[model samples]
Target: MSDILVLYYSQGGAVRDMAQLIARGIDSVPDMRARLRTVPKVSANCEATEPEIPATGAPYVELKDLEECVGLALGSPTRFGNMAAPMKYFLDGTTSLWLKGALIGKPAAVFTSTGSQHGGNESTLLTMMLPLLHHGMLIVGLPYSEPALASTTSGGTPYGASHIGGASDDRPITEDERKLCIALGKRLAITAAKLVA
Candidate 1:
């Protein structure tokens, strides 16, 4: 079966929840499945370390995950209009894959969780796409055909999918936001399946 890597970094569980929803969408498609993964937290001190395996949630992602997947669903909690440090740190380590052109021609999509309505969700999505672009991956986005893009007051964007995670990071993903995340995943899966064929 073909698998799409649902890779994410979530602090307050918002992005993780979004990842799970996206995985569901991907798995709903024929001949596709989701491989959920997360990155370890980066340390302020270079000497600090995380365990090889996380205590809970998705296990830490390996570079092989990127090379093996048919598609990628990258998600992160927003940090000053960019992906969080852990996710960025993980992406920065992908030079080996980049040199090998391992991700080239694969389908990819981005998602994010932000603390407020205007909390840089779109910008974060755009920023997240840059590295994928450099890797020569085909970027997939939620088209206007997805009704949630028109109606969502909380979080949904053409750049990708987003969730208004709330100031305290306690809010649940809204219905429209959930639908858009699912749509984005399904779109990526369908496109990847077609491209592989």
Candidate 2:
């Protein structure tokens, strides 16, 4: 079976929920499986370090995860129109994989969550694609054919799946948002399967 890595960093749980939805979508394809992983939180003090394993949620991602996966679905909460620091920090450590072209030609997609309606969800998804582009991965997106892209009042986007988490960051993912997330994952998995075959 081929694995699609669903890697994400979420502060308010919205992105995490989206990641799970995406995983479900990936698993919809025959012979495809989802591998969920997350990054450790970043600390202000450079000397501070997180435990070897997280206390809860998914385990911290390892570089081996990238090397082994057939496809990738990256997600993060928006941080001023960019990916969160933890996710960025994790990507920064991927130079070894970059040098080896470990991710080249693999299918990839992005997702995000934001505080407001215009809280940089699209920008964050776009920005998240930049690194994948540099890695020579094929970027996948939710096409307009997905009805959720046109109908979502909360968080689906052509760039990728997203969520509007309100000011307090407590809003749950809407049905449309969830559908888009699954669509994005299924799309990536299907693309990966085709490419692998």
Candidate 3:
């Protein structure tokens, strides 16, 4: 089975849940599996360091995960309409992969969780695609055909999947949001499989 990397950074856990939902969608495609990974939190203090392994949730992502995966599903929480600092920090370190054209022709997708209706979910998703695009990834988005994209009262977008996690970050993934996440994953896997075939 080929693996699709589900890489994400989560502070309050909503993004992590979205990652899992996307992975489930990827795994639903035959012969496709999800490789869940996370990035370490960036320390505010320059001297502080994260452990080699995280205390819980997905393991830290390595550059190798990017080269080895058939596709990618990137997720993060919105920070002022942008991806969280840790995720951006991790992406910034992938120059070596970029130099080698390691991700060229691969299919990619993005997902995010935000604190409110206009909390930059779309902007964050669009910005997250920039790095992937620079790596030569083919962006896969949720088309209007997905009924949830039209009916969603909470979060869903053609740019990708998203969730509105309330002010306290306690809101559960709505039914539409869940469906969109899975659809994005499935769509990415299928696109990658076709590209590699």
In candidate 1, what residue range of length 10 has the lowest lDDT sum?
A: 41-50
Candidate 2 lDDT score relative to the true structure: 0.93
lDDT values of the candidates? 0.94, 0.93, 0.94
Tens digits of per-residue lDDT for model 3, 100-196: 9999999999999999999999999999999999999999999999999999999999999999999999999999999999999999999988987
lDDT-wise, the better of 2 and 3 is 3
Tens-digit lDDT track of model 1 for 68-114: 99999999999999999888888988999999999999999999999
Off by over 4 Å in 1: 45-48
lDDT of predicted model 3? 0.94
How close to the true structure is residue 33 of candidate 2, measured as C-alpha lDDT?
98
Ranking by lDDT: 3, 1, 2
What is the C-alpha lDDT profile of model 2 across 1-197, one tens digit per residue?
Answer: 99999999888788898999999999999999999999988786532267988889888899999999999999999999999888898898899999999999999999998999999999999999999999999999989999988988999888889999998889878899989999999999999999999
TM-score of each: 0.98, 0.97, 0.97
Q: By summed lDDT, which 10 consecutive residues of candidate 3 come out lowest? A: 40-49
